[model samples]
Target: MVREVLTVSERAPWWRAPAAVTAGALPCLAFPAPALWWFAYVALVPWILLLRSAPRGRRAALEGWLGGAGFVFAVHHWLLPSLHVFLFAVAALVGLLWIPWALLVRELLGGTPGPGRAAAALVLVPAGWLLSELARSWQGLGGPWGLLGASQWQVAPALRLASVGGVWLVGLLVVAVNCALVLLITAPAARSAALAGVTGCAVLTGAVWLWAPRPEPVGSLRVALVQPGLVPDSPDSPERRFDLGERLTGTLAGQRPDLVVWGESSVGADLAARPDLTRRLAELSARVGAPLLVNVDARGADRPGIRKSAVLVGPGGPTGERYDKMRLVPFGEYVPARALLGWATSVGKAAEENRVPGSAPVLMDLPGRPGVRLGPLVCFESAFPDMSRHLARGGAALLVDQSATSTFQDSWAPAQHASLSALRAAETGRPVVHATLTGISEVRGPSGGRIGPALSTAASTARVYEVPLARGTTLYVRFGDWPAGAALAALAVYCAAAGARAVRLRRPGPEPSAPPARTVRGSAGRRAR
Candidate 1:
């Protein structure tokens, strides 16, 4: 019977692996482009079921890795144009983070789990998932894009939860609910435990929503976003792009915007080298009756390498307030470990020269307002929750992300990029202004609600937004990454307990040595008789 069971379990079915891969891709639908936010709650069911049914630990690990690769590739499919086949390689490498998570799931839910194991599964599986997310969130692996919690950007209750524990907490709850649902579907005996887990998550979310401190309504700001849209590709495309942005800013002359914002790479030349361009921006700022926050993508005269900077141009040539971009897009900005990966440039749109990183986050005060401090993030930096949280902690009234996604304008990348602002705003309890060169320009209130309609990629125009400013410290900002810390602690305790149990089971027992001596004594007594 044991041999028969082992053979049956070890027999590999080819379709099982592919099923897991397809199951993993289902979660991407919850993100933008499809925008099926509610789907996130059950999206992991099929994947979890597949993992739980794996015949052996080794096969389970393989399924986990393949599923992770599928998920990463699906969510970031828009990067195909820029990264080409290299995207697959990247996804496969990052997918390895899920191996341990898969093993944990099989251990807890594979067999007919009793109520105790089922209850533990509800917590441990989610914590394991979070650990995978935490691992892949490192900048080199790929920043926190397509986080499971980010799918709920438009959900009000989810946003409230974000205020209490950041995206980590939201993700943990989401995965926990998925685990419960999986148990409810596959483990009939564990249905009571599953229901209890679901109830716990609901109660916890409700408590946070009712008790968490809300940002006080302080005031509002009138901000104008200048989107030049697409300029035809040409040798003089940079010059033409600048001209178009200038023309658009000129149209806002009588609008009386408190501040005018432009997207990343709006300025092509170094301000110090080209005084004429500086003067042109200054004149535009004067005409608009506000300081212009434009991005400069040029070789700096004072700096060593090509730098993308957020420069503040007042009525004067320059306000001397500038923020260099701190985070660079892995392949888009520079290939990682160029000595080993330099071949990436030849195959795709990877940057030939690496851009320099900024020394620190900068909070620039809007010229005329005493308390209106702006935290500027360039392009890829917006994807990181910590960057915005840190800036908000430093007293930034508003978080602004200047981005140019012209390369991915037609793809889901723009919409996915735009959606991150909502999460950031909700996490920090601050309004966010996402200004892009091509389109998808949007503003979110401090509560993560959209202030107005978003500009589509095809639109070439400027729009004004009434951005509501708030004043308060969010729990996430005050107590950073507590959810991740808690998850780590839970995993540690489980491992330690499991280790002790294994040690106890393997310990040696007392020897059975008395039988032999008795037999020999009996034989000697019989011979004497």
Candidate 2:
């Protein structure tokens, strides 16, 4: 009887959907590798098979959640230590983030997930995953790490899609391939199964190679990035922060940058309030024979309470292009409903006390490169694709990301932080100079290619790079989330319709409907992508 029950469980349709979703989530493990990225692509077969076998409705949802839980747990385990240190009880509660991810996957792969149905997996799963990543990026809840799209950072073909629709598209296409391969294997009609799978993947590969953005080198502009990691300065004594700025300015003067970038909170207080610091940076700009783009993490004099800002100053005067950060980290920036919830804020940095959201995106003029415009994102902001997309679409020639990773010190955080710039550079089809406090300052060129050296967040240092500036927007900058969002919405519609039909079929009969036997096989083993 036990053997029979085990056999039945193995054959159960409910089991297959979860298995396939789990398999699909595997390809996302290629990042932070000593492991090869190409090997990660095969993790799709299980979900494809399971979805093809699943009964509609709740069974599908369960399959998705289990798969999502496994994937999220495996990918984000790095958070355990950090969360444990700061929010011990809340860190233990992190498992909640995976619930929605699972449900969305099962819905997309519902109703046989065959050729006709499988196409929607491309959209629904990627969109759902993207929304999940965006949702979790809120700081108080948790930091955004190991976004699935980021796994393919080093893969050339996958990176190509980044330029066209951002990293999200690559994710969609990868899921689609898994679905299509599953459909072909269980095609039932005995069609050109292998041929169809091969054709689809080939077309995707061909398109990326054909349309990939090539760099057209413009004149190089030398720039320096200053990182003074983690030392604290109070706004009350504005003079305390000025000396640090003075040292950076004094050192950077010899490098002769077209513009110098100070990492997030390089100026501890608001220059508007400090006044003296502004004059010092302006003087540094004059001494260095360039303009300075500096990040401020403090309250504005006029507004009085916003926590983050970026401003560009020429030797002559302020460029008047200042960007306040729009996305605030939940716990780090402000606690949600602090007066009502009231508890977490009392212990650590008050969530609301940290920072406020910026009102709009701003583009400033570059000093040495007269006609070129600059689009900037402060620390934690560069991780968002839409943020950089907004800048790219707005006709900014280049991208600048200023961050302070001093808190992270010498961990995986710097590598993770640096990776965002590569993906952003790929997405915008423009160069990105990611200047960080402490280190890991990097330059990523137009084709998702990286240049120069990585600085350590544990040490104080500065470096210069000759970056190429690109004009005009790429397809990614234009369409934003529409493609992936459409995929997700279409999946929901398809699953809802399919679920209703299955329910009506099961209502009158006690016995479940059975399908003819089919075996699934494709992308199951480690094969070349």
Candidate 3:
């Protein structure tokens, strides 16, 4: 009997590990701060090429894990001040989600694949990458902050694509382009196919731009944004912040603004607990001649724990409509699995106690406006596409995100947080108001076009924006994550096919038939004859 033996290769060079990490981190530049939006198209080329060159599946997976960790750390390095060394631990764990993706890349792009395999790589590789993103986007993991598609927030063409299929489609196309570029670089026989893939992406985007349903301009609203800028850190800082917001909002008198917005935690105490604060807010609303949408970061009066809420205060005071924050920041609002990872608080500024999450989304009706409705999302919740999509489906004419990134004022976090609103706006085909406590406040129209100059972190003032209101539902809002569903389906089909092939390879061949009896009887039969 003959048997085949598989050879195990030696370990990969030590330097390749760091190379993979560096390549993974390159995509961060395409995000905020540097915001080289065009860089996103080819940012994954080096990483893909490196993974493809891996000698073994295990090596490819290891490099994939390292690259994922690097990407996560690079994108979220701003949290170092709050998460400290614990951030590395998070990067490592969340990085595991990319292992399968890495293996898939290796299998598809390893060596110089033929035209057929190259075509498959363009489709399957991007699907694998999207699946990894979908997995890490869970609230317990990190949510979707640096999604590759998000880097294109400023691109009109990309924004048009987002309006049709949401960010998931944008990310898929971005990754597919990267894969095609990698193939063009390494696989000469497949260059034509790769070019076709790139062309296909462009054609799809252009088609959406030309044919996608656009939001119709219904009217315009005068919205005032109050940004208090930086308040000195002190024991009474919350009170000081509140006072600053109140003063800034008061300046809007006779502005005839339809709505006045304060940044996250603009009101330090719950209005239910502090009647004076409620009355003061109402007075400011009356003075401004508009309804006030202020965020409260305080212990809940009805609930037991701390709750961050967006409360609407009219001239009459405390409009019963309120939307508590549903999604909480992992370490910022509460540490995940505190019983097991409670020590995180000792290492960094992790939350001491978890804040209670809101039950569901709420759409508040605009004061005196019969049809207009406002959908409010708290700081971390703004990063979630589904949350905004849900609100848009619920008949929200405007999307508002109240955010505070004071801890990361000096880092890329503020800029990144602000950019997400543009994508959300484009996806939902509704104007988005991103009001922040410390800075980087911005507004985007339904097409994801900037409405006005963003308020810098250095500016402490109130600004009025003539925000255009739009009507009609975006295709993304109606279809609901179809891109993700398609990616998942593609991956499932690939996995099933791969599993069947592996089974076929491992299945034993038909057993060797016993030699004729003449073999055993040859000597004896000769003697007998």
Candidate 4:
């Protein structure tokens, strides 16, 4: 009866792991809000406790599943309308992913983890998270927005981690910290536990406060971001959209900005293909006395309709530099496994495969500044930590993401998604200039925070920004994702070895059931033969 009661309580719906994880994730949005940024660390505690108490295997798996569903579902509830059906499908599929994460947390907390067990247990959570992020962001599953670490864009110290290891590492560390806290709570009073868990976190918080990337002096390039009133679907109305690039440039021309930026897909077709439009943009750049860093959509003329692309244009001519986006939002850009899954691809009449991916990261030369390279990330690419890291690796002075969030016009998706870029800047210690097609175009210093004005696509407006182009590179940019990937691989190997040993130990040992009845039988025989 006691066992039954315990089992029932474990499986009960109320206050389950799902609720804990959900609660933990929901409060993290406070990360982007200045007064509430500290909530991120506090938010993790409950989930950590829940992980500590979970049983193994199926129950642990289910607990984690619920936790994952709650976390993602709560954070991404805004995406339901744009990706409702897809969200449901993806939610169901990702349950498999969460189970192990829950189980891993349980294993790590048990204190039985050796190097192999520790690695195995540790790798599962982050690996699962990265894979899920990758899968969801892909076109077939749904699209990438609001990944967990992205919430910390407004927090300075947390953002620093992104530039170093990418957002995956940030997510990994957050999970690790939560696990550590759980360990700290369960252990008997030990000096090291308090020092490592409580004091370590305190010291780390201080490090975050002081370790911000130094900003470069704004020697020359004062820039402007234009927010057009026209929506994405209605962008075809040129009188409404065409005048934006020109008007914004002309308005900011007096400020003598060396460059002007419009939002992503702001130019419907490739400017190079449209000679008349190119001339008009050149005129705008000339009038502004700066090169225009324009975000172009449509098939590339040079690549012959091979990919969706972005390019640079100036009074002198096109900069001969362009960046094609590598990572694409799955359903938003291209259908997933289309050849195999196209039969079911149409959900609510939203046919997939709207865009193709670019092969490499493109760093454009800012006009008048030969060494100042613009790291270009168009819309979805901004979600990929490695994309920016790749550009930063190749001597990018500034990171620029051109985005169009017109699809989720009514939701807070623009603001939520845009916040992530700030963390990316912090991670790489490079400034990020995020210009959007509809709304929330803004600037972020190396550490994730709003440094300049963000254009509101809700109105026709423009803001000229003097962005500090930092000259130094970060360790994260130089190293890339190799460290984390290596760690994950090592973890996998360790887990495999331990699992093999467990299986061997469990293998039926030498046959037993030795002769046990001889003494009693001998006494009976002596008395009653």
Candidate 5:
């Protein structure tokens, strides 16, 4: 019997680790505050280039993980105010999820130099990235906050693409463009394929704008977004918040808006339990001559626990229609496995009590406006496509999000949170009012264009927006995330094929025959040749 020995190489140097991290962080510039949305096109170029030097999949994945850590930390740095130094650790951990993405990228782009590989890299890399984004956006983890597609919130072409295929599609195109750029830089022979890829994307964008469903204004609403603002060190009193909201509402009385919208948790007590508060809101509604939609975050009046609800208050008082927030922000609203993470409140922004999630999206019928319905999403729920899509499908004439990024007022979070509404509006083909507690409030038309100047976080005031209502559903609302789904499926098939090929390459072939030895075969025989 013979034994075969295989020697494995040592790991790559430690310096490459930081290089990966730096590459990852570069993409953060593509987001808000210093939002260079165009930077996203080349942001990941360095990371892909770095992978070209990796000797194996493990090294590629390690570098990828480091880069992801950098990106995540930079993007979510605002969490430091609440999460403290622990935010870096969370970012690094989340970055580890990109290990597989690194391996996939290296396999498709690193080793070989061929047009076929370049083509595969273009499709698979983006698909893999979308998958990673999908994983992080799961309800248990952080919701989809820094999605690459989101960086294009202000881009008209991207908005049109989002309307056709949701943000996921936009992200796919972005990643595909990144991959094409990588191929363009690394493989000169594949330049034509890369150019073709770029041209195809341009064509797709044009097609979406030309052929995609365009939302037409069916009616309009005079809506007022009341931002009461917030002050740090303020007592944890919902009454104070409610009072502030009332004052803001009073200022809007002369405007006589069709609807009065307040930010999330503007009223802390459940209106059902507090008749006095309910009546006060109803009176405000009567005074304003419009239905007042107040967000109540408190212990459920009829149920056992807390609920974040949007209760409609007509001049007559609490209308039967109410919408509870379906999507709850992880750790913010409720921690996963409360028994273990319940202590988070002592250190960070985690809420003490978990707010119950609502069952279904409710399309609220406007009090006096017939044939018009308001789709309400609470806070982080606006980041989700399905919630708004369902409402749009149910015939919502407009969309409204009650959000408060007050705690992160100075951070990029407020800006990022506010930007999600534009995508949602475009995707659903309905005007969206992103009414918030502390500034960055914006109104986006059905086509995802800014309606008017955004309410800055620097002031507490009431601004009435002429929100143009669009009646109809976008293809994204009708077909859902079909592009992302197709990308996922295609990537799965590609990975399976690659995996089988790797197995074939690793399988051992027939061993060479041993030379004959006469002395071993016959003791007395001469040495055999």
Candidate 6:
């Protein structure tokens, strides 16, 4: 009797989908709150292992989609309170974006099942992931929030890589490391290749640590960040929020900071129209012996429109220096195709009147501090790298993000939002202050190190940091997104090569060996004839 060998699917286990979901959720631990950074390297191994067992492209695609759903759901789970039941539907739909990723992984890992395919997976898997990340980063889509590299915000060597090549390079290295780990278990036949890949990553990390340029400290600026800790559902009026901020900021008058920053929409009225309110802020600036940077969300008093603006107040009066927020949050600031998606407002926090965006990034002058310039990123603008890069290129000495995570403070949103400052700081080689309404306020140095303790969501207070400034630009600011561009070029080449190989394989091969005479003659009657 002969026994047939079972294919991977013939022995398919029941645990595959759950396994993918679990693997997908594991990486969240690598981010803030739990912040087990080392786990990020190995987090994807389980998914890759599942991919190895996937029988065909279709199966792999399903697994990939499921894993993607898990990741989106886990990372943005904090949105549940606001988004409610709709959050899961949104996550599952967004997970559809990973269908192509599954197909690619299967083609490289599951189809050929050899060293060549294994090697391709190591390079192409991460490339595919980065491309997916880049696509979702579009503002109309959800912006870049939980990027893979941002998990390494606290890692010194990774921050150096960001200084050299922006977050794209760091994310590339992280995915490469994950690929290497996957290879060790999933492709035992390619052990040599896996070892080499891991070694290359280690060597590259060491090189960055040993040689990356250190941020040189120029003069320091004492800046105070105030949090009002207001909740959205509370019965407190908008004016009450302002009063709380005013009270919190008033206490810091004794510290005598060079600048005072309040969270987004701290001033509900347009200061230009409300001269009385502007005067109050100017007096506060005078009392603190510094300029007060306050964010305003209101109908344009001078012009006939609505806007979200960052205004500077000096002892003399309004400094006339302002940065209107350039990038607006898609659903939060404005509903995309309002005629079509206007219904979004019924589901979540959509703007009553879509806030108008600024024309370009503005670098505002710091009153009384000659040669000191501040770049203000309002609310969601902090999530974008180009905004920060643009500000840095415009000769901004300090970068400040005025944010309000009041709605999602109880969720992962505040922690995730606050962590972005470190990446921005590293990329631009400038100090960054994340001032928020509720909490998770932070100050990061040029090298991405925290200047002081971050104010968590539980606090309603003000803290001052003697922020160290840097003189020259980092290579990242000089050459923007070069690493991502290179990765794109490489991906194109890889796809072309893979296409050619598939065509060759599909082409007709030589006929099989000539059949024996008996087989060719078929039956005995035919042979007799």
Winning candidate number (TM-score) = 1
Cα TM-score of candidate 5: 0.92
lDDT assessment of candidate 4: 0.65
Which pairs of residues clash in candidate 1, taking residues 3 or more apart in a chain or in different chains?
none
TM-score of each: 0.96, 0.77, 0.95, 0.81, 0.92, 0.90
Please write out the lDDT profile of model 5 over residues 121-237, one tens digit for every residue: 788889889888988887776778889999899999999999999999999888889989988877887888888888888899999889998998877899988898875545666
Q: Model 6 off-target regions past 4 Å?
A: 1-15, 111-115, 231-236, 506-529
Give the per-residue lDDT digits (tens) of candidate 2, residues 317-393: 57787888877765666666667654665555545365678788899878667778889998788878888888888
- Tens-digit lDDT track for model 1 on 307-326? 89999999987898899998
- How far does residue 28 in candidate 6 sit from its true spot (Å)? 1.6
lDDT of 4 by residue, 1-529 (tens): 6676468656666767546557535544653332254555456567656765755455556666666666666565666775667665556565455565566567665544444434333445456555555555554444555566665666556666665566666666555555455445665433244335445545754664567345455453576777775544453554357666567567776787766777776776666678888888887888888887777766667666546566787886677887777777665666667787564455533445456677777778887877888888888778767777778878888888888778776666777767877867876878888887678788887556787666665767778777766767665776776645765675577579779999999899888878766545677688896
- Candidate 3 accuracy as lDDT: 0.91
As for candidate 4, its clashing pairs are 138-330, 139-330, 139-331, 162-427, 163-427, 163-428, 425-446, 426-446, 426-447
Model 5 ranges off by over 4 Å:
1-11, 506-529
Give the alpha-carbon lDDT of every model.
0.91, 0.67, 0.91, 0.65, 0.85, 0.83
Candidate 4 residue runs with Cα over 4 Å from true position: 1-36, 110-144, 180-195, 204-220, 232-235, 299-307, 343-345, 349-353, 457-459, 486-490, 493-497, 500-504, 507-529
Q: For all the candidates, what are their Cα RMSDs to the real structure? A: 2.9, 12.9, 3.5, 5.5, 4.9, 5.7
Q: For residues 357-439, write the lDDT of model 3, one tens digit per residue.
A: 99999999999788999999998888899999999999999999999988889999999999999999999999999999998
Model 6 lDDT per residue over 1-529, tens place: 1122134434557687788777777788899878888988988777877776687666677678889889888988887776666567767877777777677777776633567766777778878888877877888777887888889888988888998888888888888888877777667787678788789888988888787777788899999999988645554566788888888888997897999999998888888778888888888888888888999988987776778888888987878888888778767788778898777678876666687889978889887688989999987888788889989999999999999988876777888888899999999999999999998899999888999899989999988899998888788999999977887887899889879999999999998998677645568869788
